[model samples]
Target: MRRSVELEIITEALSKMGPHTPATRLWGRAPDATADMAAEGNVWAGDVHDVALHIVTRLYGRPGTPREASPLAQAEDAKRRRDMGDEIAALTGAHDQLTSAPWYPARPGDLVHVHYEQAGDLPPFGETYIVGHVGAGLMSLQLLAHTLPETVPGLDAEATAAMAGCFAAEAADCPVYEAWFEAGPRSLTIVRDGRPVHIGGAP
Candidate 1:
């Protein structure tokens, strides 16, 4: 399927859940997964659900399944204040925030109808992933149900163009981003909300 169609399906499905994005994540400096906590790092994914689950299980203390856990319960007031367009005031007013939030499962093995990668299917560096989020500061994330045929590293052409447009569109228009990847290619970095904050690639 085309990337544009995929994004539309995602946006509609996520809307059914709530106003927020379906998932989020932070990537770790170390690429390998381990039992030790110190080794883990930031939230990263091709989709939101992957990152969201990472945040819930790692950052927050909910080590089990994230069926309906609300990571935002702590940031309610802060989120509300931000919604009012007073982020500075919100940070100083009421502050209870976390690195990420709780969301549906990210592992491809868990999803019912969504296509994804398995342990053996992943490539050497990593499996091409996707993460979808809503609002500011990546408040919500949802994993994509599909997988890319290859991986591209460093940056994505379309996504990069979109990021450049984001800086010009910010405030004037809400930002939206989409990236594609394939194996044997570097990552692509795109600035969606404001500037290119993460590495995005196409394979």
Candidate 2:
């Protein structure tokens, strides 16, 4: 029997919570900013947990006079590390909170469930893949397109790869995988009878 679509999403979200991460505040370091975006995932310790990761990518040195990419890169690196550290903390906190949170008694029709262990700091770029399965031989693939109107936004191919891997079971027997794979990011592929059907580019 195939897993429910909501279960798949919950599992997918939970899988993101990496090892050594806290269960409380699993949605990164700044709970307010991250969880507030989606009300479903905000119940750490029966309250809103602090979820903002302290971006610290500036330890190497201060910004240069010109403030070029080199200095910016350094700052970014530091921030990434800090974010990672904050993620770890969230994992722990979530663990403690889960003991009392309603997550354990989760019921059906819950579209927005947060996994305590797999939470990580929201990436600077890249879109979150929201998977939807409509039974009767069709699963809809939704991509939360991330882009900038002013500038070309960056994409994390590796992260996309990871998210794609999770859809293997549905894609294994669907024809949509080929078309979706060819079109690339911000695209959707539906799998039916092991065939992936090209949906369209993400908005």
**Per-model TM-score versus the true fold:** 0.15, 0.19
Writing each residue's lDDT as its tens digit, candidate 1 over 62-167 gives 2332221222332354366665433333222222221121221222122111122233534233222233333353422223223332433444656533322111
List, residue by residue over 43-91, the lDDT tens digit for candidate 2. 4331112221111112111112222122223334546788754344433
The alpha-carbon deviation from the true structure for residue 99 of candidate 1, after best TM-score superposition, in angstroms, is 8.0
Q: Assess the local accuracy of residue 87 in candidate 2 as a C-alpha lDDT between 0 and 100.
A: 46
> Among all windows of ten consecutive residues in candidate 2, which has the lowest summed lDDT?
52-61
Q: Rate the local accuracy (lDDT) of all candidates.
A: 0.29, 0.32
